[model samples]
Target: MSIRKLAVLLVLGGMAAIPALAHGPHSLESMAMPGATKTTSSSRATVSPAQLKPGKPQAMLIFVRDGRGRPVERFALQHEKLMHLIVVSDDLTFFDHLHPQYVGGGRFRVTANLPASGSYTAFADYLPQGGSPQVSALHLQAGSGSTASVPLTPDSPLSKRAGDLTVTLKLDSGSIAPGRQTPLTFFIKDGNGNPVTDLQPYLGAMGHLVVIRQSPVLTAADYLHAHPEDQGGHSMGAMAEMHHTHGERQQMAGMDQMAASQKAEPGSVSFKTVFPGPGTYRLWAQFQRNGKIITADYTIAV
Candidate 1:
């Protein structure tokens, strides 16, 4: 049976339904997060109608469970959100960053918009109250038509255009390899080829980078998420701190303002991470400009 089928079976077998909570969205201060323990958690996703058809949106429900089969109720915040759900097509042609709304119990709800009928993977990134960060992969399938896989290929040019902006990706070592910390820098320029100096803060940071290795079936081990560096480069931590102090609504008032404008180089954003193994990885670099989020995709080889 396929992973998606197995997930449905598991949910139907014995997973208990949880009650809805009356409170609103959680705040970091209200959570009272504790130190991380060794406890492990797992996640499973189910579609509303049991079958997803092309060009139609389906409600996707994700359940977070502990090792003993009970629902996980308490969760810590990561990047100002409780859960970050990344949905991507197997062919690497589609991508979406979403935050599922926590209704109650361990279940979160979000709508999945699959443009075409294909196999897709949902990576659930969250932190249990007493556990470390976790990534759970839930396989999702729409009405089966063509399961044709796309061959992963590296990009010849490191730079690409996102809307009216041009994003150029660069590695400090000139190339990436497994087991080594690689610094990835993105230089932003306008359509006129001028440096972009007023990049706005996004998701409590200067930027966000998500890396997923190309594979026939992706597991949690194949996904990696990174934030920008702090010192000697763009610092997401510093920008996140500012957002924390000023409050999200107040800080987000000015779309054209820069957070750490004077510290980092103009038109540049940086992130660092180590590849799990040698293979082709698809990267999505997201940043904000004039209150709009732009995602630039690039494929790199290790």
Candidate 2:
């Protein structure tokens, strides 16, 4: 099953059937990537002060290494960054997308500002220079108390308000079943309920989706990340080719004008992905409008 190509709305016959049991490191999407290596890389994140307070910022250092315990120095750019770090509280109420700065020696550094004292999960999503995409789940403890929290429940309505925009999400299939590639579409409207047509290019794409299943202890197997399908119906390889041939600056410039030129449906974007298993999942959809990034979240059962 290849995820390198975008599936047309009318043609779903060739979509990949991702296994319900496969996720994180063993996700078929990453395994099917071009030039994926058998030897996987590893990463570990350590937070300073060990114990965190309710409203203070803490320094986080992540070290990437090979399977042989050697530091992996080189990394490939994905989504305009070397690493994409996603953090969420155990209760699923807090979510943050952070990009750690590479400080050499296979180390990346960032500051984490956890709102309350509890257990948090940090998912490190990255690509080694010569390896496949990797996801490493790290643990962070705050305040050294019982790690108990409220149970996660599915959202009643799929619609949410982010700033002045109202976003509603819909799934192509009536019910989202495990092991099936489902197209998740989002529609945006302004405060006055008119469809919003002017969305900016964010992180080289129309939008980004990050999902994590509710679990006692979150791991790489419980995480998934996706991007909006290319409007031009181009494969991932073709997109990469355009990125390199024209350079990041040029490619981004071209993408900035794509919304106006394509004349696509007003305020609608879709992403096709597979749910590894049946569980309650929290999803965060991020987009940019008028140069400000907005995040809207939803909870759903598979």
Candidate 3:
């Protein structure tokens, strides 16, 4: 139930994910010490246009550097990509899972478009060679408007119906605890309440789940994300496998895709995760049915 345990459930076993999820505000001293595997910085991102335009693609370039401010090159692949970039709006209404391309000397490039004008955050998740995996956040503003600040109060929406699917989140643990692994059971059913079967494989997994912290990084854990499985553990899309003869990744550079798919217990899956801190969070579960992607949104207080 520790951070290390939670990290293991995400990036395969503890060996892969522990080094990555270890990046919360609670453990900064270990990163600042000399000869540590991870690097520290004030946290910033350079945005082109200085302001994001609504409904238009905006360029984002994040510089991965060492403590010396020099660009750090070489990234280890995680979840079938070099970097997994997550973008979310202030209200948590907008969510995107993107893969960026390493275009040059320590710069990853990706084009993002926002449907509405507001504040958005882009988190770059990657692991530099010889360095620990890190998730660095960058804040950006878009368009012109006097939009009121989005509220961040905890919303406990346990059931959500999207199209023909009704997703009910069953927290079997009764109460969630920080730093403890809570088992979450998701049920996918139709309007008639019958379980759904024939769920297709998406992005090399039975399903994909993303949990973003409300109001940004105020708690010990903010913006938590992880795919249920990528390879070996589950099946991947045929369209994606055609991209590579070795049946590997589909070269996800420049794609803002929401991934999903599944088949087991017909419409039920159970996953255990750890919340780094006590705070409200928005949960997004992505799955595929009838060859169309299905997204379900809900909220929970941990």
lDDT of 3 by residue, 1-302 (tens): 11111110111111221122235774432322111122123332233333567898765655555444455667666546677777777677788878878776676767788778876666667766544556655555677652343655554557888797898888754659988867666789998999887666565445667787775332123766544422233322233333333324444411212223233355775455677777677888877788888888777787
Q: Which stretches of candidate 3 lie above 4 Å from their native place?
A: 1-45, 145-157, 216-220, 229-264
lDDT of 1 by residue, 93-151 (tens): 78999998776677777776878887776777776664456676655566676445578
* Clashing pairs in model 3, backbone N/Cα/C closer than 3 A: 206-261
Which candidate, 1 or 3, has the higher lDDT? 1
TM-score of each: 0.77, 0.78, 0.68
Ranking by TM-score: 2, 1, 3
C-alpha local distance difference test of each model: 0.65, 0.66, 0.56
Highest TM-score against the true fold, candidate: 2
C-alpha lDDT of residue 182 in model 1: 85
Q: Give the poorly placed runs of model 2, Cα more than 4 Å off.
A: 1-50, 173-175, 232-263
> Compared with the true structure, what per-residue lDDT tens digits does model 2 show for residues 206-281?
7889988987667678898877666555433345445434445534633743643255567887777789999889
